[model samples]
Each structure stands twice: as C-alpha cells, then as structure tokens.
Target: MLRADVRAARKRLTGRIRTTPVFHTSVNGPNGQVPVTLKLEYLQHGGTFKVRGSLNAMLAADPAADRVIIASGGNAGIAAALAAAALGISCTVVVPESAPHTKVAAMWSHGAEVLWHGTTYAEAHRYATDLAAERNALPLHAFDLPAVVAGVGVVGLELEEQVRGRPPILVAVGGGGLMAGIAAALGRRRQVIGVEPEGMPILRAALSADRPVEVGASGLVADGLWASRIGDIALDVARRYGVRSVLVSDDAIAAARDYLWREFRIVVELAGAAALAAVQSGVYAPPAGERPVIVLCGANAELGG
Candidate 1:
C-alpha cells in the first residue's frame, strides 16, 4: 500500500483505535547507553497492534455482512473479535489447538464463536476459509490485505510525531503485516528491521530466496509468531523499502522478557520481546550514537504466579 492509503486508514482509525504511548528509554550498547524509544503497542485493545488493521478492514467492508471469519494463533483472533464486537458484527475465530487459553478466552469474552481446528495456523486458516464459504461470511486474513496493511501503517505515522529523528524501528514479525504497513508508511524516511524467531525466520528466509517461502514455526513464542509464510504484500514492501531481518533465539527471547520485567516493570509475551532481544543479545548491533525504536507488539500472555 502507499502512503495515501495509510493516511486514509489512519483517518478511519482515529477514534476507534488507541494511540498507544511511546516510552523513551535507553539500552546499554557497545559504547554506552544508547537512546531508544519503545512503542508500547502491547497496551492496545486486544493486547496487540493487530486491532488497527482488523478495525480498518471491517470498517471498509459491507455493514450488512453479518459475520466475519478469521484464523489466528491468538492476537489476530482477539483483534478480529474485538473489532467485530465494536461494529456489532458476529465473528468466528478458528485457532490452532496450540493457541494460548487466555487469548481464546478473550475471544470468547468478546462473544465470538471459537473453534480449535489443527496444530498449525495454516491448517486453521484452511478450515476458517472453508467455513466462511459455507456460511457466506466475510473472511479476514491476519495479514496480506491492503486495508489491514494500511491500517497498521498508522503506527509509523504516530511514531514520526512522537520521536525526534527518524530512527530505525525494530518490529517483531509473524506474518509481516505490521512490518509491511510501517515500511510502506515510512518509506525511505526511516529504516525498518524485522525481528523473527531463529526457527521461524519467515522474513529472513523469504528475503534470501527472493520470494515468499514456508518455514517451520517452532519456538517459545510459536503461538504468537507462527506464520509459516510471510505475506506477499509484506515481501514486496520489504524489498521496495530495504527492510532487513534479524533472527533471535528462544533463550534470548526469554532473557529479554525477564529483563523488561526486571528493569522496566514491563511484562509482555515472548513475541513482544523479540525486537528488544535482537538488540540485547547483540544479534542486530546498532552503530554508536544511533538511536533506534523498538516495538513491543503484543501482550497476550497469561500472567501467572
């Protein structure tokens, strides 16, 4: 999508979505403390940035459509459910059996019909599509659609206003919807980096192969970042905007999560800490005097004692 499309999405999302706050902080670097900003998008409605795209897509669709169907491991399902609830539309979310119980419960709380279909997101997606066809319901992809991508691009616009210089923004990727929106919105104005799990390096593998490819998704954050293939629109936007990828191990991700809670009193899901893990683990080193922005993408974890 283009900047104009993102702008339109932003306008449509004005009051519907939360303008998630950005926390200005510094992270220890090779030299010293390097300035950084954390976009606390995990605090958004449904505990993820996915709601932005979900709301935008639903707003543009026919209002007469009674139901909307989508397949998600967690965050996207919650997003669609929340959006559907806001618009008074029925929502059906098909999630993998491995999805977190807290997320499924949240969808149920939103009055959605939830189904456990398979072990992987791809399988759940197939079932969701078939069910939508059978019911003649509107179907929504977690990522890949123009409206969804454009809707997510609003985060970049908000960041531009929240920070001083155009710093590189580190985003955790699942299906690459959020990354594509931010990259297309910012264009060449700022650098965009995609952080993925080492096992599920969807964007990295796709970039290397010069096309979208399926990769195995198995890790601590698999439920949240478990898209086997990056979306086609995301890949195209990444190429056009020079989006780079960084891989982080599950151990590093866990460490990052602990560090956030210990230092900043921030508790987030494993996928939420992936971008910070890249910096803390030294996988994606930032140059001296360079300030980067990291996006904490989701907060759908069960906080148990």
Candidate 2:
C-alpha cells in the first residue's frame, strides 16, 4: 500500500519540486566515519525539506480548493505557508505556544494566518484538524498523511539516484513520515534507520514495544520529535517494511548541531542533527565498509528569531 502510494507521490511531484542535494560529507565527526553521505535537505526551499510534502499535498488537492489549514511545530507550517503563497490560496496554520519564534515568523512571512493553539504539536494538530473539518478546508497534516509521507519519499529517490546503486542506509526519523516515505521509495533494498531524540523516543518506544506508545518528552527538538503518538500509517510502514529505530541523546544532538556549523558550515536546526546523532553515538552503527547516509532533513533553529 505504501509503496504504491509512494510511486504515485513520486509521479505527482516529478517537476513540481526541486530534488534537494545529497552529498558524501568528508569531515570530522565524533566518530571516525571516513565518509557518510549527507542529504542536505536543510537547503530545501523555505529553509527546510518540508516544501516537498507541502507542494505535493497542494497538488493532490483540487485546484478549486476553498481553503487549506495545517498544524505543525514549525518546519511543516513554514512549508505549507510557502506553498499556499505560491498558489495564492488562503492558509491558516495552527502552532503551539511552545514553538520557537523563528518558525512562527517564517509562517507569518509567507502570508499564512498563524494561530497559536494548545501547548504542543499534537494539541495544535487536534485543533487544526477539527477546525479544518468545520471549515471544509484541506487539512495539511504535518506527517501522518500518505501524501505527505510519499512527498517525503522523494528525498530517498534523490539519494538513491545520486549515490550509485543501493545506498547503505538512511538516518532521519522525526514524525516518521520522512523515514516511512523514504523507506517505501527505497523498497527493501536499502536500510532505513529511524533516528529519534532520546528525550522524545517515539519510534524507539514504538519499535521496542512493537506498538505506538505515548511518552512525550519536551525539548527544543519538540517541533521535530515531540509528536505524542506515532502516525498509524508511518508505523505500519515501518512494521510491514524493514525500518530500524534508534534513540539518540539530546546532548549528542546539540553537539551534532555545533559540529555541522563548525565543520561543514551548515547552520541546521536540531531536527537535522538527529540523524547525525544516531551515527555519532553508536546507537545505529553501520557495518564494515558499508556506506551510511544521513538525511539532513530540516534547518529552522534560531537562538532569538
């Protein structure tokens, strides 16, 4: 089911979006990985890879769509807002009060009517989902939707085409949409590692217990990882497919953020750091001579934006 959806998603998003760059980063890490491919999706439009899903969602919707609404921690909202602006459609985004100001500003700058509701992404999602139903508007979910996940799978398409045949693995699991979609795109040929923050171990707990359990932990990375529950669609993808989950420390993620800035000069947010954290902390180490890949998904971190 997911594979079919992903194929349709790829066809739906062929030239609608830019295939972000994937690179073999040769820099110093906390560990001694000679070269790990880094999919610089941080360089995605609107400052994150979220544009892929947003544009795909918009394309999947009817052209005469009355309105669109979305709930997000930050990156997804910004992506949706930008897409709406391009299409000249009315978009209202529900965000949590806890979301960083930079993310809020990014959405507002794209002419999205921003609504601060609830205390976290899950709460905001509930509000936004209900509100969309009331208005008969399209609800652009942050990650749960098949369209959204398939849109994210485009990242895998780009990686596979760019990195020869059969890349080692992909490490980027927040909201699980990114991993689920990418895993679907790559099929069972490549390893898709689900990396999550230790503070908010959504996938780790889910894979361990073999079911989606709620253990919501709050952090700056909440926008990326504080999803109270896993997406049933995405979780089912991981289960039916072969997706491995790993947990990384918040401190390791912080160090990764700093390392990327100092080493690669790439100023990415905590979300992008999660993948690197998995590799550096030995939580999901690659086999000998196996070329591992990390998808640097989004970069919306700001100290005081």
Candidate 3:
C-alpha cells in the first residue's frame, strides 16, 4: 500500500465512513506538560478503525458475494459484520471464546452469525478460514490484505490534513496493519511509533527478528492486541518507512486508560490506550520541541451505566 492507494480508498469511502475528529490539548507527561493531538478514531463506526479496512475490502472485492467469513478478537469482527451488513451480504464471524462480551453482542446486533471457537485469535482465524473454504464464502482477514491496508492508510491521510508539520504519531499495534498503513500513507515523511503490550509484543518481536515472528499472546490488553505475528505487508512497510516499535506493560496500559477517563472523559479499550501509555509512561518520549500525535484507535469497552 502507498499514498496513492490510500487516496483512492478515501475516494471510495467518501460517504461510507466518517471523518473522525481530532482534539488538540496539553497533558502532564512524565517529562512535563506536553502538547498533543488526539485522533479520535475510537468514535468511528463499529467503534474502531477496522471498519475502514473491512468496508474497503468488501467493496473492492466481489460486492455481489452473498456470504463472508471473518475472524477477530473483537473489533475487527464488529467491523466485518458492519461492512457485510452495509453491503447486504451475510457475514459469519468466528472469534475467540475469551473475546469481550460487549464486542460479541455488537457483532450479533449487526446481523452476523457469531461463532465461538478456541481460546486465541490465531486459533479462531484458522477455524474461520477453514469454514470459509468449506462453505465457499469470501474470507476477510483482520489486517493483512492490500485493500484493507490501503483503506487503513486513510487514517494517516486524514491526520496529515488535520495536523500541521508532520509530527510523530503514536498508534497501538495489533497485527501491525494500522501502523503500516499510516507509514505507507506518510511515505517516510513523519515518524510513526507503534505501541504494543509487553506480553504480546508482536511487532516488537518482528522488528527484533527482522521478520514477522510468532509471539505468545498474554496480557490485560490482549483482547485487542492478540495477533500472534505481524502481517508481512506491515513488516515490509515498517522496514521501508522506518516505523518504530515500543512496548508498554499491562499496568501502564491500565493506568493510561484510567487517566484518559479521569482527565479527558474518554472511554477507550485497553488497546486504544496503549499509544497513550507509551507517552504517559515515558516509554517513547519525544524530543524537546517535538509535538506528537496519539491515536485513540478503538472504543469497544463495556461502559457500565
């Protein structure tokens, strides 16, 4: 995926997706008060940026297909369901048994046939692929295809238009699709920092190995960042665009999520808070006079009344 591909995706998704807002504010980081820009993509349709990729993949592929199958920990399944519904297609989502109840319920509400299988997203992905092959249904991956990554690049395209000077961007990483798309969209102009949970450091491990490597997934934030390996496309883009990787502890992620709620009244899932955790915990501190942008990428949490 590249900037041109991303621009084409934006044109295709002109009215199908939303142009989420951006908020500029100051927050007390470990260093001191820091000015930051927040890309409020958590408020996106299906409660996450995955909707962009899901919708784009379906639209770019065979829109006349009647049935589609997808596997996700939560957010991607909700996105696939939403996209399938919009395209008037039947969708079956296979998710790990441990996926959050709220996300599963949202998928069901979107008219998807929800199936629970295995305990990890990798296992569920295998099952979903097999089922799709057997049923002759179109299969949608969470974050690996060209159309999907190109669609996700729209986020960075919007960020470039919304923020000035091409500041560094902090985004949470799962399979590395979001980070890759953003990096491809920016074309090595701006820095893109990928944040991941310490326990499930898929991108970090891949960077260390100079290839996409499988990692054990276990963390408080694993519900959203459970990909065992980074996608090949993400690794290629990261290598080409100098994408940086950082890790944050589960405790830091929890604290960051709570801080957003208390200070900004923002409700985000643990994964959504990972990038902020990198900033708040001083894991990826910016240089002096460098303003950074943090992306709140998902809001699939079960907010109690």
Clashes of each: 0, 0, 0
For 1-305, candidate 2 gives per-residue lDDT tens digits of: 45677678789877767777777765444577546888888888888777888878888886566579999888889999998898788999998888778889999999999999988787888899999999999998888887788887888777877887575665666677888888888788787888877777788778778888887576655553257767777788888777877778888888888888888778888778888877777776666676688888777878632
Q: Write the per-residue lDDT of candidate 3 for residues 144-163, one digit (tens) a residue.
A: 98888999889999999899
Off by over 4 Å in 2: 29-31, 62-64, 218-225
- Scored by lDDT, model 2 comes in at 0.79
Stretches > 4 Å off in candidate 3:
222-225
TM-score of 2: 0.93
Candidates ranked by lDDT, best first? 1, 3, 2
Q: Which model is ahead, 1 or 3, in terms of lDDT?
A: 1
Model 1 C-alpha lDDT versus the unseen true structure: 0.90
Pairs in steric clash, model 3: none
TM-score-wise, the better of 1 and 2 is 1
Would you estimate the TM-scores of all the predictions? Answer: 0.96, 0.93, 0.96
Q: Pick the candidate with the highest lDDT.
A: 1
* Cα lDDT tens digits for candidate 1, 228-278: 999999999999999999999998888888888899988898889999988
Weakest lDDT window of 10 consecutive positions for candidate 2 = 217-226
What TM-score number comes out for model 3? 0.96
